[model samples]
Target: MSRIARCSCGRLTVRCLGEPSRISLCHCHACQRRTGSAFGIAIFFARARVAVDGVYSTFTREAESGFLVSSHFCGACGSTVWWEPARMPDWIGIAYGAFAGTELPPPDQQVHVKQRLDWIRLDIPEK
Candidate 1:
């Protein structure tokens, strides 16, 4: 299946093709701040499997794993759509929320559970 992930203003669009390699929920502080939420749901696919149209602004930072992470967002609306972690150069992670009306599968793994807020309970079990 394929899905189109676009910014709020519909300026930047990502055509995510086929199935994702993995889906993950991250409770790390960096993810929390990046998403401005309790956790982040990321759909991972090979970079070549996704096509991006339109220019994007990016934010780069060193992750807790010591690898550089680059987040790409819409230059017009500042809505983050995807991110690339340097450690996995071939992979692209798209924000699950970016795909409206599409119900993706549950996360295969959940990381940084220690950083999760107490009020949030998913019980999706870490892999």
Candidate 2:
């Protein structure tokens, strides 16, 4: 069965057609600014297997690598749904918060640790 995740507003639902390749905790400054948190959780999936429903809006930012990263969110509630990297056109990273009733495993990796807030301590090693 496909995994379905919806925005808090319930207006947007994303169907993930297969298991995620991995889950990550991103400490990138852009992610911190977007989420207004210490880190952002992302579930990686093959772009071909993911489908989104309902109207949504996206804000794009250029990554440090110079690739564009498009972040999708529910227009009504401003809840983030997913993101896609322009360079990795075949992959989609769904926001972990979208999985309302599901429990997320601990992040398998942490990226951009250098950008992490000094007050937040990440003792776990990245897988």
Candidate 3:
């Protein structure tokens, strides 16, 4: 299946050509800060199966795992659309919220469980 994830202004977009390789709910503090929410859902796809378009800017940071992550956002609307992690050289992570108008699979797993908010509970396995 093909899915298009776009920025709020509809300028930047990532086109995913098939089912995502994995989807996870991330509860790390960085994720919380980035999303301005309790957590962030990351939808991952193989680099070969994804295509990005539109003018964008990137912010690169070191992840908790010690690898650098480059997050791409729409230049016009400042919405984060996707990211590339040094730890996962061949996969790109898209913000699940960017695919706003479509139905997506529930998160396959949860990460940084120890950092998860006490009020949040999910049936998915933790990693």
Q: Which candidate wins on TM-score?
A: 3
Best by lDDT: 3
Q: Per-residue lDDT of 1-127 in model 3, one digit per residue for the tens?
A: 8999999999998999989999999999999999999999999999999998899999999999999999999989999999999999999999999999899999999999999999997899998
The candidate, 1 or 3, that scores higher on lDDT is 3
lDDT (10s digit) by residue, model 1, range 73-105: 998899999999999999999999999788788
Stretches of model 1 off by over 4 angstroms after superposition = none
Clash pairs of candidate 1?
none
Cα TM-score per model: 0.95, 0.90, 0.98
Model 2 stretches astray by more than 4 angstroms: none
lDDT, candidate 3, equals 0.96
- Choose 2 or 3, whichever is better by lDDT: 3
Better-scoring candidate (lDDT), 1 or 2: 1
- Compare candidates 1 and 3 on TM-score and give the better one: 3
Where in model 3 is the C-alpha error above 4 Å? none
Q: What's the lDDT for all of these models?
A: 0.92, 0.86, 0.96
Pairs of residues clashing in candidate 3: none
